[model samples]
Target: MTYRIEVDQEICVSSGRCVAEYPERFRFDDEEVAEGVPGAPPLPDDATLRLARACPSGALLVFDAQSGDEIDIFGT
Candidate 1:
């Protein structure tokens, strides 16, 4: 299974929550926007969801691995 994590660089506020919670999967780039590391091992679904929800600016998006649908962690 594969997962896709997308960060809206324009909307990101450099909160660092995603990197702090899942360093192996996310990191802050030179511009300070959270970036998903390519080829990183797939993280557990719950962990992925948590990281997406942790983004205070709601810039992180986690796609369902199988369905390719966006997971709305905040129920918004």
Candidate 2:
């Protein structure tokens, strides 16, 4: 199960909640602002959802690369 996380940079508000809560999967650079952690491996189910939930704009998106299905962490 290959997993990947992506964010809509245009919609991001730079609140930094996601980075603060899940630094393992997120980073806050002063110039670049907050972004998904680069070069990180696929995350366990729970950790993935935690990072999603921490996102304020729901800008974070998770998907199964093989299935091409959105990882419905919010069940929305």
Candidate 3:
């Protein structure tokens, strides 16, 4: 199943890691906070999880597209 990705701007530290790694999926807003690109193709589940986990500030959020449920990236 495809996953939807989002950025929690309040939690973002402006690290730019997401933007640098996935330019097509993420970009910096006027406030310099990271945000997901609209209309961008979603990444595979594994890759999406990896991207969220890679965020230094844990600002990247992942959701199950079909269910609209948020994934617990840090949960075991």
Candidate 4:
């Protein structure tokens, strides 16, 4: 299933971790916040989940597109 990957712009620190780890899936937007590339093919959930977990600022958010359920990588 496809996933809706995002970064909370307010919380983002432009760490580049997500972009560094998944350049094909994430990038620095015009505002420098990490943003998922629109229209990119779905990446494996595990891969995207790992990027979300690696976001030091906890700004990355991943949700199941079909289910609209947030995948809490932080386990909080």
lDDT of 3: 0.88
After superposing candidate 3, which stretches have Cα over 4 Å from the reference? none
Segments of candidate 1 deviating more than 4 angstroms: 1-3
lDDT scores of the candidates, listed in order = 0.78, 0.75, 0.88, 0.81
**For candidate 3, lDDT tens digit of each residue in 1-76?**
6788889899999999989998998999999999889899988788888989999998998888999999898772
What is candidate 2's TM-score against the reference? 0.71
Top candidate, metric TM-score: 3
Scored against the true structure, residue 10 in model 1 reaches a CA lDDT of: 87
lDDT of 1 at 40: 82
Global Cα lDDT for candidate 2? 0.75
Tens-digit per-residue lDDT, 1-76, candidate 4 = 6667787888999999888877877789898888877877767877777777888898988888999998777663
Angstrom error at residue 12, model 1: 1.2
Report residue 73 deviation for candidate 2 (angstroms): 2.5
- Worst 10-residue lDDT window, candidate 2: 28-37
Clashes of 3: 0
Flag regions of model 4 displaced more than 4 Å.
none
- Residue 37 shift from truth in candidate 1, angstroms: 1.1
Candidate topping lDDT: 3
Question: For model 2, what is the alpha-carbon lDDT of residue 17?
Answer: 78
Cα-lDDT of candidate 1: 0.78
